[model samples]
Target chain A: MEFTLEDISDDEISRRRDLYEPLTASVRELVDAVIRTEVDDDSVREAHRLVQAAVETLRAEQIDGSYGVRFSADLQGMPWGNAVIGLRNAIAPPVQTVRDSDGRVTADFTLGAAYEGPSDCVHGGICAMVLDHVLGDAGSADDVPCYTGTISLRFLRPTPLGSLHAEAVIVERDGRKKIVQGSLSDAQGQTVTAEGVFIVPKNWDGPMPRKARRPGEA
Target chain B: MEFTLEDISDDEISRRRDLYEPLTASVRELVDAVIRTEVDDDSVREAHRLVQAAVETLRAEQIDGSYGVRFSADLQGMPWGNAVIGLRNAIAPPVQTVRDSDGRVTADFTLGAAYEGPSDCVHGGICAMVLDHVLGDAGSADDVPCYTGTISLRFLRPTPLGSLHAEAVIVERDGRKKIVQGSLSDAQGQTVTAEGVFIVPKNWDGPMPRKARRPGEA
Candidate 1:
């Protein structure tokens, strides 16, 4: 629940890279199954009853009320649930963030039936969410954290499901603001385009951004 | 189900407006209740079930499946969803598209509990979707259809729920490619900002974009 720089050593980062990265992938699949499972109604009732028992067991083992962040020597971060950076989360898809040298940002992921809104195509709301986060990543940079001052999107085409990649970069910056550019591409690399702006607080100081807030900063 | 300059007489627009004005007010109340109600779960379920039945009854009386579009003699156009000009949609948010005299494009709306993502903030994706649509309107120019060729966004801060205003204007244009800038604002103004390249498709010749395709067209 606390941290010293000693906790984020490069060696710890290396260890999580080895251990947690694969954990994230398998857990993501488990999440997918929970949503798509075709178990009978009676079976669902039984499962929930059983899960309730496990929940009680976990409650008995608690030192804290929340799932606190956990870290190894590698500084690999794992914030589970619907967290943008989760460790062992299943509901989350194959999405992972990547940083480019110019502060551009991208996420690569596969979307499935769980994301459907139309009979086909990814749900418009889901597409917007992915774009918002990826573009937010580009605008935040590693230095000055940016919040969404304003954002806009246009659904020019139907975005099909399955593997997709999104990319964004800073098109312009004015003082505390950034104009980020990006797109979602299917595996074939046909892009579904997007662009947005990000701004920091008028002053440099505020509650720290997500990466800075580390209850997991062991 | 079709309307043209010749088929629409002044009396029809006036008559239709009289019928819909109060439904608009009632729908607003329903949305407000969805947000503020603190009824017990059983009551909530009962109310929702009753509302669904009432809506189904009302839906059956309507002869047509689509809402229509119209322009008053004053050229005050109400696209009414099916229009290239869109207004309140139950499936979509109550996004009201407004065009100013200077050709700037904007939308004014309030987002509530249904849009929440973070504990207290609006969902990042919803912010991005509104911004993208607002920016697209600028590129569309109220005439030439623009598609979401690409959009980029940057989130500077968490957008709190309740009232939000977003605007977009053309930044530049070259042939079929147009660049527009946009932002989302609160009472304090300007929460998330964005820009996009909304395009005039190179190969298509149509009144609206490929999607929103009219029932008979395909």
Candidate 2:
């Protein structure tokens, strides 16, 4: 794992979040609209055209490849391109994990129509995705990057697609390996429970040397 | 599990696939663009407005709830709301599974920037998502709906983004439970391997009765 230090100020990071997070949220809403819209064919065609037009506008200027994990010098991360919690990823439910003083991580979020599998239920794979993110987050430290080695999940019951909660804690640590346990729940209770092994590479250093460029240098 | 018999014809289903699949593909491109765009703030703002406008047009017409699994009288499934393989879901990488005569399921697809978690690697959860879908599809008969009971995944190596492959097969069965094994691989070789137990409900009957309504009646 590597972290590219972009030398961005905290304020610039905040400003970028302010600019991008809402756009991500809006795009997520657009996803729901496309799935559930019962519009006339003409309206659907029009919406598709307009969406593509916006795509063209953005594609006019872009990076060459994937957005790697970038961070400020202080270790504030801009993993906004991440699939599960990326601030700029509309596909993400964007679990906003909060770390406890004791190192437990928790998040409260919701699944919607776009995440459906069975009738009214959150897809089983989605349950695993959220669990993997929260569990991986729980195993991470500011100075180290944690990668998931293995995970086992049990679907105790069908997780409904609505308000949900997730929590993860480091159950054990063995040298460079951490054992994490996590769960995803609805109001009724925990529907999916997970346990995973997270590993910190032996060759780990810290973040990369600060790049002399500012944000948006792509 | 239930299926709404929409009385949709094969010709109509093909036509709708023609209409919506391209739209889904475009929206997916839009997602990648949003992630990698290096446009100026003014351009970003303009893109946002245009995207929201498209959202508004689609929201002008709507459905009351999520799209449940729909099928035709001949049992052609239209699980267009699925997260992993939904035809109309922009978030879905949309695994196109082919069932072999021996009942194995396989898919070859690509994961782009939007699926990244670590640098240039496909997110662990996305791998699980695609695996679950393919494994479940393998476990399912045309007459039975397979639900994931448990899944265990081992990250053999970092799964790189871009072209990839997946395969699943039923290794064993215990009455209503099907034990399935699956794998996700990069060009180099297998990167993630999975084992899952899929359950067919004890009271399984079949698809829901034909609701006398036509397609797009949502």
Q: Score every model by TM-score.
A: 0.49, 0.92
Candidate 1 positional error at B196, Å: 0.4
User: Scoring model 2 with DockQ, what do you get?
Assistant: 0.74
> i-RMS values of the candidates, in order?
14.5, 0.9
Model 2 lDDT tens row, A65-163: 888778777766678898988888888887778777687888999889889888788888898888988888787733346789999999999998889
Share of reference contacts kept by candidate 1:
0.13
Docking class of 1: incorrect
Give per-residue CA lDDT, model 1, range B1-218, as digits (tens). Answer: 12322245558656554544334334333433333343444444444443443333343333222333334444444444321122322323556666776778777777654454454466677676577556766776645665666676666667877778889898888888888888888998777778787777677566653223221110
lDDT by residue for model 2 (B2-53), tens:
5677777889889888877777788888889899998888888888998899
Instruction: Name the top TM-score candidate.
Output: 2
Task: Indicate the residue-level lDDT of B185 in model 2.
Answer: 89
Q: Clash number for every model?
A: 42, 0
Flag regions of model 1 displaced more than 4 Å: A1-156, A159-218, B1-6, B61-78, B82-88, B91-93, B203-218
TM-score (chain B only), all candidates: 0.73, 0.90
